[model samples]
Target chain A: MMFLSFVKKEFLHIFRDPRTMLITLGMPVAQIILFGFAITTEVKNVRMAVFDPSHDISTQRIISRMQASEYFDMTQVLHTADDINSAFNKGKAELVAVFSDRFDENLLRAGKASVQLIADATDPNQAAMLTAYASNIIADYRQELLREHRIPFLIEPEIQMLYNPQMKSAYNFVPGVMGLILTLICAMMTSIAIVREKEVGTMEALLVSPLRPVWIILAKVAPYFTLSIVNIISILLLSVFVLDVPVSGSMFWLAVVALMFIIVALLLGIVISSVATTQVTAMLASGMLLMMPVLLLSGMIFPIENMPVILQWISNIIPARWFITAVRKVMIEGLGVSYVAKELAILAGMAVFLIAVSVKTFKIRLS
Target chain B: MKKAIEVENLTKRFGSFTAVNAISFDVAQGEIFGFLGANGAGKTTAMRMLCGLSRPTSGKGAVAGFDMIRQPEEIKRHIGYMSQRFSLYEDLAVWENIRLFAGIYGVPEKEIAPRTDGMLARIGFESGRNTRVKELPLGWKQKLSFAVAIFHEPKIVFLDEPTGGVDPLTRRRFWEMIYDAADRGISVFVTTHYMDEAEYCNRVSIMVDGRIDALDTPKNLKQQFGVRSMDEVFHRLARENALTSNAN
Candidate 1:
């Protein structure tokens, strides 16, 4: 019963501070829209320079085919190799395709043609993607040529992109955004709020009260937990309706995982508050310590498989990584709870461990 | 008269340093007990242990008949603590702060409204009931905090330098509130550096270097020390401690 009053006071504190209210309520929508549209890994409308000396039907066909695809925008037609270098230097094109003079003859006589593709390797990921797209276009052109000539001596590898067939980057980001934002808002806000009491000396009054130390920590976190749930619903809604991100799995399982993750975040916040004596220190600890790891190691923006072996090992310990994987499995893979059981168990274990440590630390600090 | 608080050989040590070293004292049920000490004289530490906020390293103490070590929770229920810092929610309105403490202290829902209104009127802040605590003047905040501390009417209210930086007039007024609370059968265990305020207490203990060097009525302490004022009494005791430590 006393706990309920503490929760009420916490809510009043949140609602009265417009800055905190704005960050808690407004951040998720803004972040979802920002991540969905502005921040994307999928390359689109990539500018390319084509140097086709032959100007033959085959070369024209390939260039036109490349232009036809949504991925490439043929920005310049280079007359010489010098133009290719200048086009790259001036940032006029990300990819340059050069064909030899006898390209059409070689295709007709030898059933294959050499196309040299040069890409600026400044951003290795984007460069690799652009090169892959060019190669795919050339391969498609080769298949069309063979089909038209009635030739059947080619190996065609059929590719299928499972789970996310359209390859929408938004599908990947929505779940990550859910993990990052929830962890950020829940962990950072709870820690700062608790430390604010300590900074202002009200925590002493609270400690001297009849409320148990654990109950006081719970009351401090209860409001943030509610706000996080609201954030989850809003983020999920935005992902589904606005960004067209699908929730193929059961909403019940998703909510279960989300609640577990939120608890873990809140426990982390409690641990932080126990160590931090000031609001600024709490903010710095949560923002720097939690946000950076969640963003980089959780596979939020970068794929975990692509990280170094040691980094991958480190990422395994990040709670958000498990949560993001679980969310992806549920939201995109349409998998049942059985598919995400390991992730769920790990998250639950982390929640228990963090809660235990935080409670112990808080008790020590209070005494 | 019954004892509101009892302490014997209360010693709190932080590793090698003794913060409150084996201090012993008692307060009558309605007495205003002034606890005075130098900056690092362990007054806050002893008060913290008595309030059940901190455990005594080794001692026996009780507040309102509850053991300090074994029944700290019971001690919490029957005592109020006001720290040197104005420890109230600055963002909350005056009445909301009262209601929050009332609720935490388990004041019934039915009594919260009347009690809150009464507290506001008593503090002469009925007009500012809706004003945020941060907007109130420092003196008013201190007064409101004191009023809230005693709102639950605990057997004992511990004030830890409740008038640290307030003006002399305001501090005097605050002492009046303390006297009023004490007169209502609530023992006031107050710690202060203000020697003049120490004179108002029924009895005062002057602590130097974690030990109480003197404990008596203000008039008696003055006569015993052959001093004209409590300030002189306090200065003589503190200077003697400094001189002894230097000799060591």
Candidate 2:
């Protein structure tokens, strides 16, 4: 009864403002479209500078084939191997293809040839994609040789996903996008809403009313919890329909676990609102502070195994990491609910701990 | 008259400093009790303790027949509070703000609309119930805030500087509303830094350095202090306290 009015008032706050509506509903789609399309995980249109010493038929054919495909553009033709550094430094090319002096002769006589791909590894993901594209193109040339001249010297291993067997970039990152968007929207929005009441002095008014402090905090978070669930549903729809990333696992488990993570995020917002006296403080506390760790340490973009051992250990405490991990298992790997039990346990533990901390602080604030 | 509030040795200490130091007072039902103080004289602190917004460091008090310490939540059900800062959601319409506060106070769902309309009618604010609170003038906002505070008809209502930053004419009108609430047997415990407003109360208590320096009717206080007005009475009390502190 009283709780319903509090929840209704919270909804009124969100709906009466246009910007809040956009941020709560539109942010997920915009971020997903931007990440899905603009930040491409699969490399294409990569500019390449060649350092071909013995410009033989095989070398010419391989370069032309790579250029003919949509993946690579042979941008600069270099005179010597010494030009590789300058070509990379000039930034005209993301990668330089350097072939050994006797490229075709070694292939014909010794069944061996070397083509070194040097790429800018500053963005490790793009660098890896560039090298992968280059090797795949070279292996294609090797395939043609075996079919035409009966020579076989290469083996190509394909990258595949169970749902998206062709390994679409969207398939790889949809879970990650879900992790980033839900954590930020749920935590930041909930905190700002609660802190706004404090800033406006209505919180003190509500506190002095017959309503319990626990009910007040719950009312503040309830609307955002509902909104975040809306966000999760829309994100899943966009992943499946727009981005072509299928959820191969049971939908029930996926929704259940996502709701659990939202609880953690919302509770985090409550704790933040308890410490913050102003809306701006709450925003910075939940928005920028939560973002860096969520984006970097959550294993959303960077793999946890590739990180330093200390960083890997540190990532364990970040709630988003467990969420993204569980999402990948359920959405991409087609795993069962039992597979995410450990992740579910961690998130539930976080929710309970935050609940206890918020309750303690709430009682302290009352006194 | 029955006592609406009673307190003895109500002290609130923030570490080494006591904000409200062993203050004691009471308000009879239907009385307009004024709490006057200088800046940081701890009037707000004592009011918060009575309203169940804060726990006293040590002491005892009862608000609306409930123990302030052991039954803070119970005390909340029987009292209304208006903060020093304007307490309505500025973005909400007048009726919406009324509904929200009334509903939170646990007014029956069916009674909210009629009571809202009745209060608006009595205030003679017709046809602007849909106006957002921010769009309303400061004077009207203050009136609406008072109306909402007592809308649930709590036995006692605490007003913390309810008329700061309003004009004299508008302040008079606002006090008329307060007088009407008190006439309905609602105890009004109000605090103000403005000495002139203290004259409007049935009984005024001047707080100086966390203590009630004087408690009496306006006429009695002036007669006792050999002063002409509540303003002079307040100045003499504060100035004497300043002189004592300087000597110490």
Candidate 3:
């Protein structure tokens, strides 16, 4: 009964305070839309230069096709292939496409043409994508030309997309959004609540109560756990209905894993509250301490494999990385529990360690 | 009558600063015992030690029939505390605050409702049970805070300047509530700088320079200091201490 009343009171506070409402709900929506549209791994609208040495009908048609594609915006039609290096050096173009000399002679004689694509490889992923898109356009043009003359190739490479076959950005983002939202709700909110109690001087009342420090800490965090679960359900509903994001695994399993993550987050929040003296300090600490790790290292934005070795090692310690991995396996890949046992066990161990640390810190502070 | 609280040479130090220097006192059940001192005279530190919020550097003590140092949790279960500031949740309604406190104290659900209703009526706050604590006047909030502090019927209630900033009329009404609690055999360990309020206590102790200089009934303190009131007695003792310091 006491626990229920405490939970009810916490909910009342969350409802009454406009700041809490804004941070919990408004910020989640804003971040989702921001990351969905603006902050993305896939680069777009790359500038390019076309060095068409052939100057023939087929070469011009391919150039036109590349321009029509949304991925590339051809801002310049170069006069010389030598200008490619200068254009890229001056940051005018990220990619340059060149066709061999002989105009239409080679294509007419051998029924084949060679094109060289040059890209600024500073950002390797962007360069790779640009190269792939340019090549695909050339391939399409070649296939069309051959079909016009009824020519057929003896050998062809059949294309297949193994993972993320649909290539829908939403499918990639659902797991990320789950990690960010759950961590913020369970960790940041609880820290703020604990610091607020200390600020208002009511913590002294609880400290003086017959309630043990461990019980008090548990009671303080219990409400946020409940709310975070509710938020998880809300996000799931929004993902399925609004975003049309699919969950391939068991919903029950997903919920169980998410609850375990929430528990870990709550313990982390308690540890933060123990070190912070005020609400502002706690909020800043949680944001810098937890949010940054989740954002950068959780495989939500950056690919951990492509990162520097040092950074990859750094990412290994971030709890959100493991949770996001688990979630994606269950949701996107539809992997079973047996397949994700290692990640789940690591998360469970992390939760236990965090709870133990929080308990020790709470007891020390009480003493 | 059993002693509700007892302390012998109870001391508390904060690093190099001696906040409470070997303070000693006793409170009988159903008695109003006041610890009187000027600001920073260590009244709070001593009271916190008795309330089991702060540890004493040295000495032994017992509160509410339990050892204060070895078994703080037990002492907590048997006592209530209302800090100098109004510590109740400002966003919570009067009845909700009552319910929350009662709940935290582990009051059974079936009895909480009636007890809360009865408490609100007894405090003459039945009409405003739904009002948020922040919206109420300072006096009303102080009264409400006091009622919440003792709602669990702990063996002893600690009021650390509970009447600060309250008007005289409200302070009197608050004392009436305190007196009623005391009459029910609940000891009151109150600390206040209000010289007028000191007269209401069954026994009063005045501290100077982190040490209790005098402890006695109000009449005895007045007679021993050859003063007409507790204020004059306090003034005389403080003036004497200042003179001794100057001589040193």
TM-score of chain B of each: 0.96, 0.97, 0.96
Off by over 4 Å in 2: A40-45, A49-57, A64-93, A96-102, A109-168, A308-313
List model 3 lDDT by residue over A204-261, tens digit each.
8888887767666777787778778777777777777766777889787787788778
Each candidate's lDDT (Cα)? 0.86, 0.85, 0.82
Candidate 3's residue-wise lDDT over B6-96, tens digit each? 8999988878999989888889999999888888888877877887877899999999999988998789888988977777999998888
Worst 10 residues of 3 chain A by lDDT: A154-163
By lDDT, is 1 or 3 better? 1
List model 2 lDDT by residue over A1-367, tens digit each: 8888878988898999999999888899998898777766667788888888989998999889878988888899999766877777778877788787778888887777888777765455576687788888888889888888787664332221111122324465778778787777788888888889899888888888999988888888888888888888898899889878888999988998898998898888889999999999998888767878888888776667668999999899989999988988998989998999999999999999999999999888877
Q: What's the TM for model 1?
A: 0.87
lDDT, ranked from best to worst: 1, 2, 3
**DockQ metric, candidate 1:** 0.79
The DockQ scores of all candidates, in the order shown, are: 0.79, 0.78, 0.62
Report the error of model 1 at residue A69, Å: 12
Query: Cα deviation in Å at residue A228, candidate 3?
Result: 2.0
Interface RMSD of each: 1.2, 1.1, 1.6
Model 3 ranges with Cα > 4 A deviation? A18-46, A51-57, A64-72, A76-91, A94-106, A114-169, A249-253, A308-310, A336-342, B13-19, B38-40, B55-58, B226-248
Chain B of candidate 1 achieves a TM-score of: 0.96
What tens-digit string does per-residue lDDT give for candidate 1 at B66-125?
A: 998899999998898898887799989888888889888888899888888877776677
- For candidate 2, list the clashing residue pairs, or say none: none
